[model samples]
Target: MGIIWSVIFSGMSFYWAMGGRLGVRSLGGALYEMSLNPSPSFLAIVWLTGFIKLLGAALLIMLLVHRHNSKLDRKLFYTVKIAGAFLFLYGALNFITISLHAFNIVNYNLDHYATFWRLAFWEPYWMAGGIIYFLSAKRT
Candidate 1:
């Protein structure tokens, strides 16, 4: 599941890098506008992010397939733990902050389209990835 989450996110990034338009507006604000007319640097960053997501997926996969090798497992164990916590907290922070602003609980500035997607989809999706990463590591 963690691998799936990472792959899907990477796919989105790769697609955007290649000029795909779907869901781009959900980025909102400057990013959305920039994506529509993406500069070379922007495309490169998107592509790099896609590869980064693949790396995360690869790490999770390593935890699944490699066993009986105590040394490597120990390192992966800690790495995944840290990565999982980061993923969880990243999503949670965005979710909480977006909910606060979207609901008028706070008067923070956020793009409307971004708030909708982050609140309803992206942040939850990230949190789910974090959970799956934790579960995978636990099995390791």
Candidate 2:
């Protein structure tokens, strides 16, 4: 059970890292377009956010790997569970951020309904799986 949760956690970390990479590329393009009349503060914030995201994803992957290797220990198991919960929370935040961006509530509209629904629904399913795996591993 611990091994299973570790795998799930690792998979999610990898998925998030890939997503972050794509976001960085897209945002870089957008930033380039805005550079003609650039806001230095805005550009700084974008770069900072990208760095944090990439670092967090890397940390998550490392945590998952460590957890997988130490699955026999209760402390490591709990650590994985906590990390999974954090990932799910991050997913929820990402959903909200995308929605805000798409709706033009904060930034210009960048998301369509199709992409919104895919992230809002499909992404949460994996989060739920991660939570379930954590809970079941506790039972074992």
How does each model score on TM-score?
A: 0.90, 0.42
lDDT of 1 by residue, 90-112 (tens): 99998898788888998654578
Clash number for model 1? Answer: 0
Which digits, one per residue and each the tens of the lDDT, describe model 2 over residues 23-131? Answer: 3223333542454354766556555555644553443344444344454555545655776687577667766766677667766434354445536564575466456
Please estimate how well model 1 matches the true structure, expressed as its whole-model Cα lDDT. 0.86
Best-fitting candidate, measured by lDDT?
A: 1
User: What are the RMSD figures for all models against the true structure?
Assistant: 1.8, 8.1
- Candidate 1 scores a C-alpha RMSD against the true structure in Å of 1.8
Report lDDT per candidate. 0.86, 0.50
Instruction: Give the backbone clash total of model 2.
Output: 0
